[model samples]
Target chain A: MIPAPYLLYLGHSDDPLGIKTSRGLAHFVPASCVGEFRHDDCPLTVGMPRMTLAEGKAAGAQTLVLGIANPGGSMGASLVADALAAIRLGMHVAAGLHHRLRDEPELVRAAAEAGVRLFDVRDPPPSLPVGNGLPRAGRRLLTVGTDCSVGKMYAAIAIERGLRARGHAADFRATGQTGILIAGEGIAVDAVVADFISGAVEVLAPARHDDGWDVIEGQGSLFHPSFAGVSTGLLHGAQPHALVLCHEIDRPHLRGLPHARVPELAECIDANLRIARLTSPDARFVGVCLNTSRLPEGAAGRHCAEIAAQLGLPTTDPVRFGVAPIVEEIERCFASSTPITTVSA
Target chain B: MIPAPYLLYLGHSDDPLGIKTSRGLAHFVPASCVGEFRHDDCPLTVGMPRMTLAEGKAAGAQTLVLGIANPGGSMGASLVADALAAIRLGMHVAAGLHHRLRDEPELVRAAAEAGVRLFDVRDPPPSLPVGNGLPRAGRRLLTVGTDCSVGKMYAAIAIERGLRARGHAADFRATGQTGILIAGEGIAVDAVVADFISGAVEVLAPARHDDGWDVIEGQGSLFHPSFAGVSTGLLHGAQPHALVLCHEIDRPHLRGLPHARVPELAECIDANLRIARLTSPDARFVGVCLNTSRLPEGAAGRHCAEIAAQLGLPTTDPVRFGVAPIVEEIERCFASSTPITTVSA
Candidate 1:
């Protein structure tokens, strides 16, 4: 029944739950699970605008099956009304919710209407350049979507498929990315952190877009989720050098949340690199992007490669850990200390 | 013709423009034009969520119609493939591409689906919420629809009916404003500057669920046409108190186009209030929300009410102006003139 010509369900309470699709039960249900029907009415809260011929008699639906409730299991309005019934009725909707589709709003408008490309699920997801395009001045990853499906394209395709399996040259700058503007929370998390600072180290991913993604001009918390609007859209696009702080641990199917806790994901990547070095102190360096989905075959990626070898980033995935080995260990800690010009004043 | 059940045309180069009704195109374009057609893409591109489900099935439209030669254009990939055909076909979609539905991701997922309810073409139909039924807070001018109609619920109900006509209080805060954090570009230019800061002072509005008005985040320097995602969702959701720069001196019809001359809408509202006062320098205060439609009604709203009475907070509506008295005279020239010690921290 999910054959989809438009079937949006999105429920939690108002009722309408069962729909099944392989081509069996499509009874029509949802007017709160069928009781006397005729429900619709929300043209921006009735100031008017509800016409299209009363949504074709309350949706006799060529297949439009809207329903709602959930917004509590961590965000939902039936996923923003099945993403507004597939963006105002282009029709062909379907939903169970699935981890609140990131930030809901109709599954982030049905993953932007099923283009479902962004992967910066905030953190994790990044494995590193595993496949699909990118690499030619590469090293990118910008996924931003602070509100819509906050996954930023599943964390920039799991960190551009884990830096293309440790070879290098990642991609997703979404078209632009030269002197590294990177930016946050959308455009696929700053093209997956400018493809991991151009070298394709390990993880970056953050910054999804639509009309969003600011870099500097006054910082702006870098798209919070704790600076995961893809590293605050790459420290407001390009104030980058170091701020990689990915996190993801827990496996019984991605358990325990809070970024999967590794000391609370290194205190949320050292509190987003001290809030991106207090909002850009010329950015110093910092890295982390672990997530194996519940440890095992290699203990949370070898305990994040011994916690980035005691914070120096020797990690190239001896077992597994990324942000391109912590941006090559924060570019070898600013080539051996003395940097930190106070967040690029 | 612009009817319902399901109809989508959505175009660009090929032709066909505008027509997205949820409940009234007269029962499936009973007369008008009927299941229209056409496509070239550009609905806000990037890959447009898989080119809006392959151009909504090559414009045969399972139920989606989009157009965006440039109506408030910006989120490329053809408006994320018209937000993936209104989030994967929940349909009834139409987005000739206007600017002010607060970030239109298919009308923010059809007002967050679940018993659906969206209809905005300047609004005034559908029904429901007649009295003590809806309002819980205020500010709700929603018209969202990124892919098709990027008016994000008509700039969230024109910023909750221009902050309830200015007495303040407003409503339509999407989903509890759980995250209506605007900073720059879109989100309908920050829900029309949080509906002009709930009509120049007092505050609150921003709370409506069922999706549409809920999670409106957006942030800084987005892009051209209409993309600062509504001024970065109003500087990541009202971080303003002083900045109001405005531009559009003439050629303005915005989403409906007509003449359109954005110029970056005053440098994207001064780079989204210089990044919301550098993220939160006391959530800096800024002003200006002009759209006099090429200036008239008391000319630029009376030159923004004599510059908000030389920055003191005057102007009741010699024609309508209240950028919060020049953002309280630029928050009284910084430091010490404090007041918003914390709105969330």
Candidate 2:
């Protein structure tokens, strides 16, 4: 779990990935949202953007996590200004973004003078050799999304929790921001160089003599218009035996681009299997984790059922329900003589 | 044409994209290969490595292009030593590899002292806004490959020449080191950040009021086991109105990787279209450019005929024969209301 004292400065926006637009961060990590800072030029959104940097400190905020995953991975100028103010108020700043806050000379100097740690979640791992896509002895299950921000990380985390509940030794390997914050380590797969993406995954999920299951958080989607490259790289890199398909039932189009429609669930599954088999010849789709928050009242459970019937697979809202089905499938498939793809040719 | 004064330097290895495994450099720009340089420890190959840095300078070598694209990018220490020596000899060093020589302090200092430039072909362009993938008025024909180093640049150059002969305005857009050297300006698509790959293409092929066809040199292959990401980004980034598929008949497997076989021509074409159409809905494959240098002596022309018969498309070795067939297809398709994918749509 992530540490409590952190100001999620939305800077006049309501759509930070972890926080609910209406609830103002009530759900995910309780009491973690101490303050909501805003730029003067922008109107307040969601819960009133009333808390100042000083008030956040008074409220026991220890650090500021740039909670939003902005497109193009850059923090805009207004957010940078708010971040600087937070650093001046003696708050450690952390940004899990493509553009590093540490890269800015002024922010670097201010953070240094204020004695606050500026953590960039996307710091690339040291150079790695190309991934041979060899299978690991330990069972590795990766959660790949239908698109970015479709709850791949959340699904992986939930699946891991379910595995642990069943008295299994399970490890969660994060490949993005929120996961890194919760798990305290792992490379940002999208930020990695093109050639080294699979190599980085190989490093992240090394073969364990224990053969304990490792749930790998995936990034991007093979059908995503802009980010499919990252998706393909991660899929090919993680030569996993089982995969959890994640989707937001309400997403009509790719997150940012209107031109890119989300491929049909069947199409996405076929595309992923075709690519995944390039490395893992027998990669199997374990289950489907749907984010149904955007659906109208009472539509969540029905959406899950419809998908379950349609794909003939276990389907549920990992957050509203739980990942028990997915976990059971993984353990059963990996622990038994299930004909999983092995690394040795 | 690539500038005359630059010397081609393949350190230790005789392979630099193309040539007989033994004869280091031949066929592309005559007398441009001053000599091969090898560190004392590096055993000589492809005719004894005989050129010293001093000898290269005396042979009128104004620049040293790191001709080989090494796996995982970084040059060996011996090559860096050779580069530093050339820098000291007042020769500008240019590397087309993903590893930037500009990152090295010793070479930086040596180049500064010698007052010579360090040209990194893979340097990212000035950051640009995300591409909207709108239909541009100007016709853009991109040369995509079945694998890297399959003469995409050569095809683009040849097509541009043929288009000019037919009294049309044609421009060749280079997207790699060799093409950049030939065209004098273009981004190395592989070196670019993932988000910016398409943006760079948008910049490279901006809308022109004049109806000119921009012939773009593509990078990597969509089916390439290692660099599919680069390939995907380049294909979708260029959003070319028309595509020319470049293939080498003798590439039994993807470069470097032994198990990843090249897809069949039809499969490759379909896969590229599926990805490319995500950005440009109606993008079409105009022709094929085959590099058959590795084939038996007189078999090149016959193979081209067989492929042309099979695909029912114009096919030729643009370097050996010409790109006239490809130019004709582009003009036939795009010069009129061909129901092409519009940028604005």
Candidate 3:
């Protein structure tokens, strides 16, 4: 697990989407974020005070988090130098990229001399079990998406907070790097072995004895050819009693594939439900989460209202508005009794 | 690639299913099989003459194939000793178990000293692309299943042979260990990283100018939660114009999970077609392959006829009865015309 009180590294990234990890950590767990670090060429910021490696260490930062993503998830030479600096200062370095920090010989030697740890958030734990599809004791709500990066993690985190605020027991279950960092521990399901995709999720959110809600963060869309398998596995493993359909307000196409168009919300919902029912027979959609960052205030409100009316589900932007309506729907659907303890392996 | 003229290592396995690799090689590629090696306690045989490592090497065997599977895919101490013995005899050792031969220091040193290679068939090749989901050229037929181990690979191989016998150009694309051994080279899709499951399959079966067919051997069922992700990714990546549904005559529950019931034939067919359509828009099932090994001849015939009438598709046991009906259906559906080149990325 990555040590908290992080120095969020933006590197040379300028795109807002590239710095989502830092932004997520800053917005959700501000107390754990000590400061931001970036070069002069980088313009993106998560609205935190700036600091160098020495300054961040002095400010009680325990780790340097590489919060920016680039094409192919490669680590640049400049970034490697910065990570080396952090290692020299006796602070750990963590990254959620496909490239592992431990693979670099220079950084490995430096970290060895300084006795600092390296955390690869994308690496799954060893010896993950195959999914049994057995019924477990717990209420679960999974956030599925219309496409990748459509605010699935945001909705799950918000829903967990909302449920807790309403005197209900709940915890956010992370399935990606950003979510794992925010939750401090989780499996990057996408990086797991293909055979154990569902199995990793099964272990991440196992049988809970408290009958509380496990707000599971979903991954890629069921319609996304690149990662639909991951999404399908996560769905079956989660076996959610309630599902929150996450969608972007104005997606031109499926992410990174101009040749493929995004599937309709109804079709996506049907597919997800059909697949999810293999594990959780009573799985159903409880709400819709719209990533309305692209739309203006009035337009976002109108779109949310129209979609909610058309689909007969509570719809809202978890970032701009809130997930209270969705939490209320979840409560309405699964009241005092537990709904997933009928079958056991 | 594994060198030919293999000495199949049974490794004291008694169950027939445990020795599927040897059986598959003996049945599909008899020319490559020099002889079989087994311990005294082992009763299983693929009907090949028994030979020791020296005897097999004298018979011109170049590789020693560990053709038996044990629990957890582990290499026992006895098996390691045997592998080392084979390596000392200057025979390249190959295994498809989860435990890599390269990970065993004794085997590695022995192979290095003997100037031999260790082939881990389950190890996926590096640098596989993420699936683009583009409509590729040529016709393709993928074998989908109702559960794991329902004879998808056998059906695919049979169909490819049948298509060739009918003067059609077809190739059997392997996706598992046994199929890989038979076909000589393939990526075990299940062993690939979760994110690249579909991508690996895409690389395995690429665009062809000849408008031939790639009969891809399918993996786990869409209903089998343990491995449905691999199956789904394979399905999406294959993008077959025609699908063949595979099932066993009488199965109790989903493989390895007693609590999970197998899905009905109609539901399985509909789900597969719906998912396959994301890439191949006109994808449809052309036939059903039943594994009637458990049924009597008359009962198996009756079952196939009944299912064929009910589903309005050709249904036959690829092992008991040839896959001629399925290959005929494929020919009828995709006759003399290019059906998959309408869209390009």
Candidate 4:
């Protein structure tokens, strides 16, 4: 079992992109990976500290999360050493990297000796039956993104919180480990057995709750070269009536894969709608959820405005600006189809 | 490892549908399941005999395959008894039913005592990574169906055989156990990790074989409630340049679900094209592979003609009329784009 309130580890990284994502995960989702931020040499602009294992323990770090996600997803010699060190330091280590700490013989031996757990977020599940989501009809809202790790989960949680604040009977459906931890329960869509990928969703968002909406966390992207299939299975399985499209403005290209470019905001919107409409014909693009934290002052607002104007949908960085605009559109959609009372985020 | 040339067992049954498919697999693909056919009450028209385990051994049965597959896929008490008796006789038992023979406690105990093996065809694979098949340039042809068990694998094998007969360089990519056993090597697509469903196809039909065509066997159905996700993953993963829509003339409804009606042939064709074009833009519907095995007298020929005239595509039951018409379109599609030279079935 994973003991929460983690120690975020930003190990020595040569790659620029890996550094950005690791920092982003820590800076944005601070509550999930709390306690002391450990790094070898983080930038001055970031404002994180370089801490030793003893220093981390003094700060009450229950678990040390490997903050560095490799650029090419290659499992190498260096990453394993860092995780091994963390295990030896009497910390339950959590990693979201492609290189699983559980797979390393030395790391497993150390973890067992220390009586600590190693949580690999990317591990696919063991068994699943092929799903029948077509027959089930319940309200679900999903977040789609232009690239991986562009704040789909964060946006979903924010919208769910906003709706909940207004006293609505809405729930957030987590599709990944991080979201699952935050929400307390969810199916890891990517980890499910291939035949049961969509079935996993069917099981998660059962058709029983007719009065409330299920704000489902989405995975990957339609344009991502390595994980688009997960995106498709999720789009079909969730069968969302309304979709919030998330985009990372600073990302010029797909993460890791240099050859693949992120689809244009318009194209991403259209493609997701087309795929979702295959199963849910009434599927509509409700709003745009922007991740413009990396952009300079006044730029994030301007970017949201321009895209919102062009697409004729309300847009905002759900984290900074509040998810009221996106949540409003969803509330509007649900209001017309069903007799629902109360305003949402 | 699967032992070759199985002893086909048609257990006691009243279901006409189960009998036909069993006989068809044995008749069409004799090499995979090699020994004498066994049944308790063999009909005269079918031309097969009821044989005891001792008789089956005398006839050189290496493995006993539970030939009767229920429409609802239930493995009853009697079927388990037959399999246990076969195991005691020192024959490896193989079943394709939903009620996994390997899951039964008594069967497991009996198998251990007798030194035998059990194979469950519907078991999904261990773990799989997501696929990126969009970059591949290999010429691939997939057989999609209106519903499950509608001759997709049969059609793919026939087309590959015909292409090979005409001295064309082509290979059949298997996605299921029967096809895997037929080809002697293949990852079960349905059993693969959900995130890696499409990825499995990418590994199977890689871009290296740019010169030759890959006749890919399809699974489940885009319209089947229990398995549409498999259909979506395979379609996106295969990235086929040309797709053949397979249909059975006598299927009144989807396999087990009576509520869900089979989609019209035209609608099925359109839906598949829309889904496939998401990844492979140049993908086209090359032909219609009909399964008119149950059609009486001259009705099968008449039905083929009507569909061929309406859709304006080459249509035929690959088993009955040979896969010449379907192969003609695939060859034509390939000749214009690639340097492949040959006439095929």
Which candidate wins on TM-score?
3
- For residues B1-345, write the lDDT of model 1, one tens digit per residue: 233323433444422223222112322233332343335542422112233354444544433433323332233565455545454455444342323233656666654762233332211111111011112332222221212232333233334444334333334433111112111012222222111211111122234332222212221223222222233333433433333333334433333423433334444433444445422344322333443444567676676566455543332221144334432333345433333333224
Candidate 1 vs 4: which has more DockQ = 4
* Tens-digit lDDT track of model 2 for A74-99: 76788788889888999988777778
- List of clashing residue pairs for candidate 2: A135-A343, B134-B343, B135-B342, B135-B343, B135-B344
* Model 3 RMSD, rounded to 1 decimal: 4.3
Ordered by TM-score, highest first, the candidates read 3, 2, 4, 1
DockQ of 1: 0.01
Better of 2 and 4 by DockQ: 2
**What C-alpha lDDT does candidate 2 achieve relative to the native structure?**
0.74
True interface contacts reproduced, per candidate: 0.00, 0.25, 0.79, 0.43
DockQ scores for all the models shown? 0.01, 0.40, 0.64, 0.36
When summed lDDT is taken over every stretch of 10 residues in candidate 2 chain A, the lowest stretch is A18-27
In candidate 3, stretches whose alpha carbon ends up further than 4 angstroms from where it belongs are A39-43, A50-61, A70-72, A76-91, A113-115, A337-345, B12-15, B39-43, B51-60, B70-72, B76-78, B88-90, B113-115, B337-345
Superposed model 4: Cα runs more than 4 Å off: A12-49, A66-75, A95-106, A120-129, A134-137, A223-225, A336-345, B9-25, B31-48, B52-54, B66-84, B94-130, B208-210, B223-226, B336-345
Q: Which stretches of candidate 2 lie over 4 Å from their true place?
A: A1-4, A16-51, A331-345, B1-4, B16-51, B335-345
i-RMSD of all predictions: 16.1, 2.2, 1.6, 3.8
Task: Kindly list the per-residue Cα lDDT of model 3 for residues B61-153, writing each as its tens digit.
Answer: 999999876433678899999999999999999999877899999999999999999999999998788888998898888999999878899
Give the range of the ten consecutive residues with the poorest summed lDDT in model 1 chain A: A130-139
Q: Which residue pairs does candidate 3 place in steric collision?
A: none
Name the 10 consecutive residues with the lowest summed lDDT in model 3 chain B. Answer: B336-345
Most accurate candidate by lDDT: 3
